[model samples]
Target: MRRNIIPIGDVIAVNQMLERRGSALRVHMHDACGGQSFSLRADDGTSADEASRQAVGEFFSARGHAVEFSAGGGDFWAVRP
Candidate 1:
């Protein structure tokens, strides 16, 4: 089982890396609850899913929650144990 609440430092580092890479992906950290969420969109239409999948596959795969990518808009979309 994966732990949903990862270290805040890891989240920060990931965000920093994203910024450095100029990636459209962004990780939203919930400090009050230690939950993380991300949403991505690309002008090319296909980049959104690709980016979201890659981002989540690399990062959140080990976290407590799994991100389900869709063309939806919500900060807290879904959380699975």
Candidate 2:
């Protein structure tokens, strides 16, 4: 299975929006090949980074994929099965 890497810029933008609104948000994406998909929702009241990670991690875990985040803080990739 091919991996799906979420861009850092996208994550950073989403994080910034969540931080500004202090509200819940959802992000949905499908793999380039259209074989896999993910939906993530982040609730309000937590740090943007943490909430984003939790949502992304849950999406991957439910689909039996491993979640990996970049060291710098604003990106993630899913290791496909």
Candidate 3:
């Protein structure tokens, strides 16, 4: 999986486990830029989902983003905005 790490601030917080509901492949962003939700990668397969999730977490950490993932597991990447 490949994802572009956008330099946003602390917005996402919480661990999302996509084992049950699979996973969210993309999301829409409503801001001044104005554009549809960007599709960074495909989260359909099992490993793909895991890779995407880990990438997201690492992306946030690399940018010093203040976010947290679910402690154990879940199906959604919880965020706080």
Candidate 4:
């Protein structure tokens, strides 16, 4: 039951908005000592699912994550991953 509301500010950041709408994010957080993860993305505009991926990518970059949109066939388009 994850959601897009970070609650940091009334105005959600561009990256947050992008992540929310583009469906391009997932994460595994760790309060322990370490963490690991993976993600999948579609942004070719070839399918409805990829429609917002571009926005998500932009948002991720804005948020300060190193993003590779499609170097990998299933590049973790998800910003969080």
Residue 81 local lDDT, model 1: 53
Clashes by residue pair, model 1: 3-64, 4-64
**Which of 1 and 3 is the better model by lDDT?**
1
Counting clashing residue pairs in each candidate, in order, gives: 2, 0, 10, 2
| The 10-residue segment with the lowest total lDDT in model 1 | 69-78
Q: Rate the local accuracy (lDDT) of all candidates.
A: 0.52, 0.54, 0.38, 0.38
Q: In candidate 2, which residue pairs clash?
A: none
> Model 1 compared with the native: what TM-score?
0.46
Model 2 lDDT tens row, 1-81: 567565545645554555575546544455556543444445443333665666556654664657666564444556655
Model 4 gets an lDDT of 0.38
The regions of model 3 sitting more than 4 angstroms off are: 1-24, 27-48, 71-81
**Candidate with best lDDT:** 2
Best by TM-score: 1
Compute each candidate's TM-score over C-alphas: 0.46, 0.40, 0.31, 0.33
Tens digits of lDDT, candidate 4, 39-65: 332343333235454554555555554
Over 4 Å off in model 1, which ranges? Answer: 1-3, 31-49, 60-81
